[model samples]
Target chain A: MELSQAARLDQAAEVLPAALRRRVLALPAAERARIEELRLRGGRPMFLLGPEGETPLPGTEITAQTLETVLEMASRSSVHTVLDQVRNGFVTIPGGHRLGLCGTAVMDGKTLVNLRGISSLCLRVARQFPGLASEVLPKLWQDGRLESTLILSPPGAGKTTLLRDLIRCLASGLGCPPLRVGLADERGEVAAMAGGVPMLDVGQRCDVMDGCPKAVGMAALLRGMDPQVLAVDEITAPEDVQAMLQAAGCGVRLLATAHGETLADLDRRPLYRSLMADGLFDRLVLIQQTDAGRRYTVTDGEGRPC
Target chain B: MLKLLGGLLIMAGALWCGVSAVERLRRRVRVLEDLRASLVWLSEELTFRRSPLPKLLEQLARERSGPVELFYREALAGLSQDPEGGLQQSWRRAMVLQLDFLREEERQVLVEVGKTLGRYDAGAQAQVLAQAARRLETIRAQAGEEARGLGRVYTALSLAAGAALVLMLL
Candidate 1:
């Protein structure tokens, strides 16, 4: 089945507490499909955020008991299985749906040992959009060599959505040769690999390493998969950039996304200074989505608009 | 002819009582053994497969029979359907309503494990299960000894009581 068709929002609703499950079911099918997230906090009203905005779910108040049950169900009655994800404040279930959690942090001398008394929960829907990266593909290919690209966007601007398609199309010979694409999905969001299988279609040539740090995953991809192109989402750490540089030096193309509006955002960061000074990115793409519509702008590494 | 018939009738009744007493003892022992074996399987399932409670229980319910199967089926139904109550409460209810083989104390051990079953990570849950499995082994041993002792005593007593009653009647 097509990955987009297979990534169902109902997967999240199915694991919800029974009382809220009814409310989720009551939502119109189209609205349900458009939901970006479902947030529930103990003693607070449940809310669903979509393209338009937040809609408070009436008569659906999250209770402590209910929140505990949701965590139990999401973790499959075994907290150890999802302990690493839990420590990171989110757990990825089957079908690539992620449940964000916040609770009393059990700390052992500054390191978070685990979570207890969990009270806040958010279920983010991971989805795929076919052909969403068409506008940027041409800009990335020049002289028969695909340029390493970096996607830029603010929160809720569809950067991950666009990047997912970019990885899919590029992996399937959309622009250059059908190269081996290695995805370092730290949060399992890009490829949504569940049980070592991509829930979303990332093309036939894509190999994914999920649930690891971007830096570690990038290195593993370089050494293990020997991929020609490596993709990672949300590169925020120094280690991630170092790995990207190392992989690029090895002749592996890099695709990375970050929380930013433009190249100016990267220039402001001390961590990405050397990366920008090196002219590492061949093509820079900025995505903006507002009430008007979604727009994609392509630029060169020197910040000149294409 | 009438006295002879009466004596034979008494002897037949005594033998039946002896056999019936032995059967109940054997059933109790068999139930304890089944419970221990099922618990061993449960530990293996948790250690190796790490399936969720409902799925694991469903699998066991399908493959097994007798008292252990009943417990798994009841626990599965309660867990899948009970949203109002915690799994511990559901487990207790299922034990009370469905499983008849276990003593109240032995059943309490299973219920106690349910209290932490889904509340923590897999490693912790597996640890709890392994302890419960060990406890189950101990219970099974005790039950075996009890059955061996009780089976012989009850059978002999029942037969002797029947025979003495027949003599008094004569």
Candidate 2:
């Protein structure tokens, strides 16, 4: 049956298996648009379609009430368990759409007990922006060895998208002995796997462990996987800092990302604090979106002229 | 005339009881509503940049004034004391203590989240969060229903007490 966009979205919502449904419904308008766009680009089905401030679900506004409902539910569940639910929370109804979450935390000292009052949510529609990585891969590798690099950008700046493409490029071996790549996709953002298999083709040479902690995963890769380079995303935690240091000590090149609009943003984070104190990373790559399109600049750890 | 005077006194006592009951119910509702509202704010803070999860949780633990505040306190206590033991252990222990207060699915989700965080890999962590989110939809739907049910019960009880007061006056 040919489904209309709204119908497709409705069907997707209906099949979202309960947990994902709430997250999707709670997404802000802008985030929903992004998800729709990604889904269309990826040729995946879109589970949600409607104008801003008007969705099918009642009381599903991107307000405190809805946010509280979502968080309360999350708090009752485990972080890992809820993340998995978020992964499966959508169906490729027609435009390959997906939803993501952002929220407040209830902390006990340094531990996150529960996430409450979810505020912003992004619904990225998954699209396979193929050939995007080809341009960047050549610049990232030299003499067949991967460089220790850091990808920087603000949220929705295509950092994960770029990383995903890079993983695929490395995994394909680009006509060389396949690079054994270990992707520590902490948020399932890079690989987007379903049922233990990658929904996206990250490449045959890649080994993924879905829902594992980044620090532990890096250590494991170094000890067991024997990869030439280790890649992870969005490193912020102190433990993550410790893990990355351990990886660098083992001589494994590293690639990662942090939330920042510019180099200055990088300086304020604990991750940056470690980077300066430890000098662990070799190159810092800055990605920016200008009218000319996506631009890239590679600099040394100090942000000095390369 | 004496009998009528006694009847009037009894009616006044019943009226007082009715008003007090209504006030009590209203207060409880307000407390629950406030808790719900605070939870929403806390959720938003967690996702905001420049604010890490641990810091936010600690703030909430210190400032919260409800039953959930204890959960926050335990989490903060666990995290600050053992910064090296790993965040998952503290979260699990604190969350488990309040597991009985949560819905069954929520309890299961928390348990799984703790386990997932213990592993090594971003993909795994993402998957765990995704799964927990899925279950959360169900839990939210059910919670909404539960909240509504409680509201209805309060209303009914208030109405019944008011009616009893009126009968006593008659």
Best by DockQ, which number? Answer: 1
Tell me, by lDDT, which candidate is best.
1
What digit string (tens of lDDT, one per residue) describes model 1 on residues A1-306? Answer: 463322377777766877788888777787787788899889989999887888888899888988888877776565656777888888887766789999999998988878878889998887778888877888887788788888889976887888889988888987557878999998887787766678787887999988779899899989999998999888889899899999989998888887889788888888766777876788889998768788999998888887
Can you list each candidate's DockQ? 0.39, 0.02
Fnat by candidate, in order: 0.49, 0.00
Positional deviation of A184 in candidate 2, in angstroms?
1.4
**What ranges in model 2 sit over 4 Å off?**
A1-80, A83-112, A115-120, A175-177, A302-306, B1-170
lDDT of each: 0.80, 0.58
In model 1, residue pairs whose N, Cα or C atoms come closer than 3 Å (at least 3 residues apart or on different chains), thus clashing, are: A79-B121, A79-B122, A80-B121, A80-B122
lDDT of 1 at A126: 77
lDDT tens digits, residues A233-289, model 2? 888788888888888888887878877877787668766776756887767777887
Q: What is the TM-score of each predicted model, taking all chains together?
A: 0.85, 0.48
DockQ computed for model 2 against the true two-chain complex using alpha carbons: 0.02
Residue lDDT tens for model 1, B1-170 = 99879988987888788788778777767766776677677667767876666677788789888766887788878876774465677777878886665688788777878787766666677777778878877887887887788888887887788789889989
**Candidate 1: residue A34 Cα off by (Å):** 3.1
